[model samples]
Structures are given as C-alpha cells and as structure tokens.
Target: MTTTHATGTREEWLVARLKLLAVEKEFTRRGDELVQQRQALPWVRIDKAYRFDTEQGSVSLADLFRGRSQLLVYHFMFGPDYKAGCPSCSSIADGFDGIAVHLANHDVTLTAVSRAPLEKLLAYRQRMGWTFPWASSAGSDFNFDFNISFTEAQQRDGEVEYNYLRGRHAMDATPAPEPVVQFAANCGTDAQTYARDRPGMSAFVLEDGAVYHTYSTYARGVDGIWGMYQWLDRAPKGRNETGVWWKRHDEYARG
Candidate 1:
C-alpha cells in the first residue's frame, strides 16, 4: 500500500507538470504565429529626410545608425507635449542601458528616439540616470512617420483611421469593427495603450551603404518588457487575468 501511494503521487505530479507544459507550448505557438504575421507586414517607404540631434551633434537619418548596416530605433514617448517621460517608456528605457552592450555585439545599435528637444531629453536622461543613447528628433519628421508624433490636426481629431474599416462583419452576421485610436496627444491616459497608434522599433538594412527600412511593429508591441511582470506574480490582479499588483513608479513613492 505504501508503494502504491507513492506511485500515485508521482503520477499526479507528472500529470500536473504535463498540463503546465501544454499551456506553455500553446502560448509559444500563438506567439510564433504573431511574429510571423508581423514579419509579413508591408514596409513603408521612407523618402523624406529625418534630421535629429544627437550627443555627437546633428545627424541625418542614415547617420543615426552609427556606421552599422542595421539600425533599431525605439520611438520613445517623450515629446514636448508630455509633462514628463512616460512611465511605461521609462521602464523600457531602464532595460535599454544593459541591452546596448549586448546588441552592439550583434552589429546592431539600439537608441531611443523622441520628439523632446535635446536639452530636455538630456536632462530627463540625467534625472533617470540612464546611460543609453537618447536622441532628439525634434527637427525631423521621423516621429511623424512612426505614428508617435502628432500634428495640430491630429491632436484635434483625437484619432486617425489608417484603413477606414468603419463597417465590417466578423465571422458571424453581426456588425463588428475595431477602431485604432490615437489619443496620447489629446489625453494623457492609457500611455500603455498607445501601442495601437505608435510605431515600434524599426530596422534598416544597409546594402552597399544604402539604408532600407525593413520592419516595424505596433500591436502587442512592448510585450517583451511589459510581460516580464507576469512571471513574478502567479495571481496577477488586472490585465490578462493575472493578479499581479503593479503600480507606476511614481505611485509607489507616495507611500
């Protein structure tokens, strides 16, 4: 009877482990599908010149890559309109300092691009104590093309429809529609939710010294960084059904 009980417990544990593996595999498979979809997204042609001020001085779009054939620009949400650097963007910037060295080993340069003037950007970087390369795109249309910077009309409208999918039907015979809203410039709410409007890190491949825009993402964008919190708390309270208690950095300081 003792041997039989031990065997039963071992089997139960194995079953539980197998269940967890199944869930993990399912999640991985879904993630792979989404990545493949993003890889297939059409690349927009970038023709207009983008001039940005860097620590090294003013440089054109191609110069920002710093001699590397491929450039990855993180369109950070620190604009002149923003009172302070976005909390979510600040979290990502926190990780970037450590990542810079590793990415350099792979022949890629990672830099945070924002619309904030050079002085403001530098001051904020000093305030945060970040050592990563943060550049100002205030003089260029770089942020505008990336969908992060808003114009006067864009801020007034509060949103922009990319494809005009106003009326559509889902698999069922019911009117279904999804509106991609851009409200960051209009309202300061949902800083995390601006993924629907903001363009993600864009990669440019150089062929014979010519730069070409390769890839960009917006939806489920900052998952790599933001999703890390889910693992720390088994019972995440909000968002994705997880009960993890997460608060902005500023919120925790009040106590």
Candidate 2:
C-alpha cells in the first residue's frame, strides 16, 4: 500500500530510533525530577471532618484509607443529578480495577469519591464491572472542600476554581462546548450540571493519627494516570484526535 508517512532503509530507521531513544531517556529523567518535586510539597493537615458513604456504611475520610497510611482518591465526576458517570471519568477509571490490587498491597488505598449517591455509584460500578473502592460524598462537603465538585451558586457567581485556575475551564464556557454538551447528554443531564463536577485526583497521608492532604492535580494533570492515553501517546499515530472520539467502555460497538 502507498503511504504518506516517511519511509526509509533499515539503517536510516536505526539512526533515527537511536536519536529518539536519547530524547526519551532525557524525558524519563525529567519525569523523575517531577516526582521528587511533587513529594516535596508541604502537606496540609485536614481538620474538617469529611465523611463518605460506602458499602460499609457512612465513614470518615480516614476510614477510606482502609487501614493504609496513604490514600489516593480519584475525584470522579458523577454528580447527584446525572443518570450516569461522566464518559471521560469512566474512561480514566477503566484502568483502576487492574491496578487496585497492586496499589492495595503497596500500602496505598485507591478509592474513587463522587457527589453521586452511594446507590447510584454502586449501580454504575456494577454496570462497568469495576471492583475498585468507590465512596459517595453526596450531601457532604468533601467534594466541595477538595475543589472537585461545585454548587449551583458557585457556578452562577463564577466562583468555581479548578486546576488552580479560576473561570477558565472549557466546561465552564458560556454556551458550553460541544463535547461537554454531548457528554452531559450521555450522562442524562445538561451541560451546566455536568460541568459542575470536574475530574481530578488527590493524595493524602495519615500521620500521627491525623490525615494531611499531600497533593492534588486536575485537568490535564490527570493524563499521567489515564492509562489509555499513555499507550496512545506511544502509538504510531499518537492521539490522532479531531475531537471527543471515545465513549464509555460498554458504549463502544463490538466488531
């Protein structure tokens, strides 16, 4: 088949591959440095009592740790009004089941927290066939305090702050982006309700019987943990994106 991409002899390919290898190695080293910097950030002690509803019943934030000293919470975007979880968040979470076991054994409990009711979260989890821990922050300030979920008042007053930026998210746009509208409809809600809940991840540590917020990242900062994107980045065509081209796992048609 004729191809538009560059093609060359084996010798030329090897030369190019070797040069790319050097650049990849440097990128790896830079990523290592970032790891150190992330860990070095000051930990803020959480004094507010945040509770979550789990299969075990309502529990404190510390209980979500599952007796582990470290906790990693994926701020899933499943608002109370939505009929289903966000497609983007669902895509990111598709990888959780595979890694949850390894993370648990490593003394880190990975849990997903969302504003949706426990019943809703559990039903969706069953639909997705995910076994990872999921907790409900419905009627709780946990999601709001972590800055992952917002209220109608906050959205109306333009007080929503996300990814360390104020009033700049595409989801918060006046007319709502096409992707946001599409995703919102897929979740059985409107764009405004869907955008109120943003996706992110947060890390916490239990020290001296107290919990401290270690770090949190939002928006593209979460790309590192979205397993599919990592593989796509290494693929021949890379992301090869025009727009929102993915759906929830079960929504995809089988060949």
* Number of the predicted model whose lDDT against the real structure is largest: 2
Q: Native-vs-model 1 lDDT?
A: 0.63
Best by TM-score: 2
CA displacement after TM-score superposition, residue 151 of candidate 1 (Å): 1.4
Write the residue-wise lDDT of candidate 2 on 69-91 in tens digits: 99999999999999999999999
lDDT of 1 by residue, 1-255 (tens): 254333457789899879999998999999999889876876555667778898999988778777776688887767665545655566667778787888888888888888878888898788788888888988677776665555545533445322222221121111212221223422243333332224356677666656778776543565565544445445433345333233334446664
- TM-score between model 1 and native: 0.70
C-alpha lDDT score of every prediction, in listed order: 0.63, 0.94
Please give the distance, in angstroms, between residue 85's alpha carbon in candidate 2 and its true position after superposition: 0.4
TM-score of each: 0.70, 0.98
Q: List runs of model 2 lying over 4 Å from the truth.
A: none
